[model samples]
Target: MRFALNHIATPKLSLADFLGLARRLGMPAIEIRNDLPDVVGTMPAGAVRAAAVASGVDILSINALYPFNVWSGDVPARALALVDYAQACGARALVMCPLNDGTPVPHGDLVAALRELVPILRQYGITGLVEPLGFPVSSLRTKREAIEAIREAGASDVCKLVHDTFHHHL
Candidate 1:
């Protein structure tokens, strides 16, 4: 089995340094974040691609796009931008996380959002990984829900769930 380090595990490191750490650890891949160090916000996609290539580590993914089930206001824009970035940076996928603020999102809404995102992901040749947050207040709390939603949205080909063990056991 292969293991990849996530940027959140070492939030203090610079992108270059973080990639270096992955290489030093013999990890062939690393997950960068848009939140912890805000790699997506602070650096251009080309730079991210360059750093990953220079270090010989694959960029597994960008940590996430939050509240992806909402599908309104700035969410669509954020999804588009992140998808674009993932494509440009040679990342394989974008993690789509649900809202975690004690609000419930209807199953239809969740499927609708996933449907809306399919074209964008396909356009950029990027995969959408639905990571169900298992927090008490999270709208999506189980992989089952994400899977159903993905199936309902007809996004099975382009979308998949992220089985985060910590969240699963939460």
Candidate 2:
């Protein structure tokens, strides 16, 4: 299997520096986080793309879009923007987390949310990596729940579960 490191590993490093380290360490891929100090989210897409090309490192995925499913009026537009950003950055997938907004989102609502978002993901040729946060307030707390939502949304081809080990044990 190919090895990949999350941007969290070197939060303060520039994208170019991080890519250099990944190449030196022989990692085939790296996950970029929009929240990182000096990286994709803040940098211009051309710059990020240039850095990735120069380093010869494959971008596996973008770290995340918060409460991706239950998007409000402008949230879906923001998500689309992120999807475009991911595509421009040569990233294959967009990681999406369930609602962690401290309100209990019903299972039906969760399914509805996924249904609404999956089409947007497919339109951009982006994979939706649904991550379940096992927090008490999180609507989705297990891979099974995410899977069920994907199934319910009829988006199995575009939506997949992302099991975060740390959250899985919580």
Candidate 3:
């Protein structure tokens, strides 16, 4: 069996070091992050792509666009930017996370947000992995809700579920 690493697994490592670690550990793929070490924020997409190529690590996804349930403020812009980065950096997908702050984002709103994101994600050839945060306060608390929203938005072809076991069992 093969395995991949998430950048959060080594929050203290530099992006270069993280890539190297993945290689040493026999992990051919990895999930980069926007938080903690924040590779997306600190490095250029080209540099990230180059480093991953150099290390022979496939970029599975970018850890997330937070509060993706709401398409307001700069969320749309941020989603575009993240998708652009994922494409430029050779990542196959963008991990789209929902609001986790106890605010209620209705199913209609969730579907609307997914619809808005799908076209952009398609343009970039990046799949959107909707990761429902299962915490009690999370706006989206189950994979069923995420899948329902994705289907309602007609995004089933481009959007997928993360199905985090930790969150699923939470």
Across 1-170, the per-residue lDDT of candidate 2 in tens digits comes to 56788888889887888899999999979899877653655887677777888889988888788877676877687788888988888888888987786887788887887888888888889998999888887878877877888998898998888877767676
> What is the Å distance of residue 80 in model 3 from its true position?
0.5
Task: Score each candidate by Cα lDDT.
Answer: 0.93, 0.83, 0.93
Off-target runs (Cα >4 Å) in candidate 3 are none
lDDT for each residue of candidate 1 in 1-170, tens digit (9 for 90 to 100): 78989999999999999999999999999998899889999999999999999999999898899989999999999999999999999899999999999999999999999999999999999999999988989999988989999999999999988988877676
Error of 3 at 150 (Å): 0.8
lDDT of 1: 0.93
How would you order the candidates by TM-score, starting with the best? 1, 3, 2
Clashes of 1: 0
The backbone clash count of each candidate, in order, is: 0, 0, 0
lDDT (Cα, tens digit) per residue for candidate 3, span 26-113: 9999999999879999999999999999999999999899989999999999999999999999999999999998889999999999
Stretches of model 2 off by over 4 angstroms after superposition: none
Itemize residue pairs with steric clashes in candidate 2.
none
